[model samples]
Target: MKSLILHTATRLMIGILILFSLFLFFRGHDEPGGGFIGGLVGAGAFTLYAIAFGTDLTRKVLRVDPITLIALGLASLVVSGVIPLITADPFLTGKWLFLEWGNSDIKLSTPLLFDIGVYLCVVGFIVTVIFSLEEEN
Candidate 1:
């Protein structure tokens, strides 16, 4: 059975969940939160949506295959490791780049890239599993 309240609440909450997940992802490299937690939260949001609706709608909403997310995420992970090798550093050594933007400096690091890859992989793997289980039901 369909639920009016659930549908309405899900429509509102999904965006909030995704935004919050990003917040965690950004703060992770420095603080307690990180890619793994962010991805779990993100996957939970979609899983909630799947439960309220169905797997078909969930797939449509995603707009891309979960496998694609996994592939890209793996590529990101590999690239993060390879970046240090190019500079003659040990594998997976943290590298930082500073970019000046309008009198402010932005710091980018390979660890963050690795974390992002983890985030994508977690989300993709969980969602794929959830979709499979939901479909089988």
Candidate 2:
């Protein structure tokens, strides 16, 4: 019962934090932030949740194994990089995606996708670490 409340609160906080972290991440592309810092901030949410609600619950809520998450993240990252390579561009070059909506334009890019992958990677990595630590302790 107590654990349930704590878990709920932490999960809510994690959702909020992940959104904020994404905002920071996307905003930071031109400013002072990027994938790494934002990823860590996002990962912090899961870590706190794990700390409060035990790893089993955290894993259940997450609905994906950490190893699988990490592998997917890595695969996405590799695929993102490969796009440029296939196009005969240098690795890590940014790819822009333009969306036309009525009279407005929505601009997306590979960098954002890469950042998302990084975010997942960081979360999975941290969760794995936290779970291991808890087991050890």
Candidate 3:
């Protein structure tokens, strides 16, 4: 049975949850909250939706297969590791890149890439398990 209130509230909360997940992800590099927690929160958002609606609807909202997320995450991790080796740095060494756009300077780093990979993997794994469990029922 679907609760109309739950479906409506979940639709609203999903966006907020995703936004907060990103905030946590960005803050992770320098602060305490990193990819792991961010990904968990992200996965929780989907899980909540699945409960309110159904796993099939959640999958449609996801747009891509969970396995694809895992694949991309792994690839990103490998690339982050290999990038340092290309410069003769130790494996998994942090690399920094700076970009200037007009008056704004953007700092990019390998660690952030690695974190992104972690986030994707965590979200993918959790979602896959949840979907599978739902399908079994």
The estimated TM-scores of all candidates read: 0.94, 0.81, 0.94
- Per-residue lDDT of 40-133 in model 3, one digit per residue for the tens? 9999999998889898899899998998998988988988898999989999999999999999988899988999999999999999998898
lDDT of 2 at 15: 84
What residue pairs are clashing in model 2?
none
Candidate 2 local lDDT, 6-113, one digit each (tens): 767886788898888888787776788777788788778778877887778878877999877788889888878778887899998999889999999777887877
Show model 1 residue runs off by greater than 4 Å.
none
What TM-score would candidate 1 get against the native? 0.94
**RMSD from true fold, candidate 2:** 2.6
Give the alpha-carbon lDDT of every model. 0.91, 0.80, 0.92
Candidate 3 scores a C-alpha RMSD against the true structure in Å of: 1.2
Supply the TM-score for candidate 2.
0.81
> Which ten residues in a row are the worst by lDDT in model 3?
1-10
lDDT score, residue 70, model 3? 89
Candidate 1: pairs in clash: 28-33
